[model samples]
Target: MKIVADLRDRFGVEPILRVLGVAPSTFYDWLAREAEPGERELLDRGLLTEIVDVHDRSGATYGSPRVHATLRRRGIRVGRKRIERLMRAHGLQGAFLRRGWRGGSTKQNPKATPAPDLVDRDFTAPGPNRLWVADATRIVCGDGVLWMAAVRDVFSNRIVGWKTSDRCNTDLVLGAW
Candidate 1:
């Protein structure tokens, strides 16, 4: 009512307030208690510091979800949406990833000569030296990814001989054998 009287005496503000579904009195009341420029900047700076701190402490690994958790852990009350906004503003992000089972048995090639299935998936032997199964798996080492060919005794399921190389050449399997 006071705002309507004040606005009526000054510039026209009733139509705009009516369009926004808020009373002119309520809008003027909010304007009176609005945050100044300096206060808003200070709040933004503090929030940015918290965001950066959480990101660095996470070894740059935390996404918005984890960052939200970290903020709550430190007693900083924040919502996930707010954390996401802050992270976006700072250009901080987590690693990209694909979801699914990673590696599996390769489809048997019709053209290429197949290594005989000596064990026929039995994966069992009566004695230690009776059967040996071989397969190649990749491992990351100091210098680069190393392709390792290993032979395991079916009886004990223990890897007996293994060799690693930068390339998946026959030498790796032969050397392991």
Candidate 2:
């Protein structure tokens, strides 16, 4: 339809309509119709305003499901699918909160005695196996969370050893070495 309108002045309506596979009478009838919002369109506009208001009031944390529930609580009956559709159409989205490490200390262990800085932060080693750095990280897998520990040689910057286990403990790091 937009193609027909844009090319109508250039190529004239008949040729454009024929090429677009649209009848000329149908196009003319559509063009002559009143340019007013239909009942459903007006309702959607009003609903969109309400949806935006609800989304803002919730600090943009409420998705379509929660928004639908909130509307229902306020005596505005609407489907969850409709709310989802409207939110998507208007480019509205909910906040996504990521889960981070929560339980143990992520820093150096305070209970254990601190080791002396022998290298003084200089990672360069005289030869292979002379200076090795060890670290562990948690990986999320399909079964569950798995802990991985790796030992890297500073001379070659290569991983000399690695171990994966279900538990993150001294044993895991020792096994890596």
Clash totals in order: 0, 0
Candidate 1, which ten residues in sequence have the lowest lDDT sum? 100-109
Best candidate, TM-score = 1
The lDDT of model 2 is 0.87
List residue ranges in candidate 2 displaced over 4 A.
Answer: 1-113
* TM-score per candidate: 0.53, 0.42
Q: How close is candidate 2 to the true structure, as a TM-score?
A: 0.42
Q: Give per-residue CA lDDT, model 1, range 70-121, as digits (tens).
A: 8898898878987798789889997555687455435557899976876677
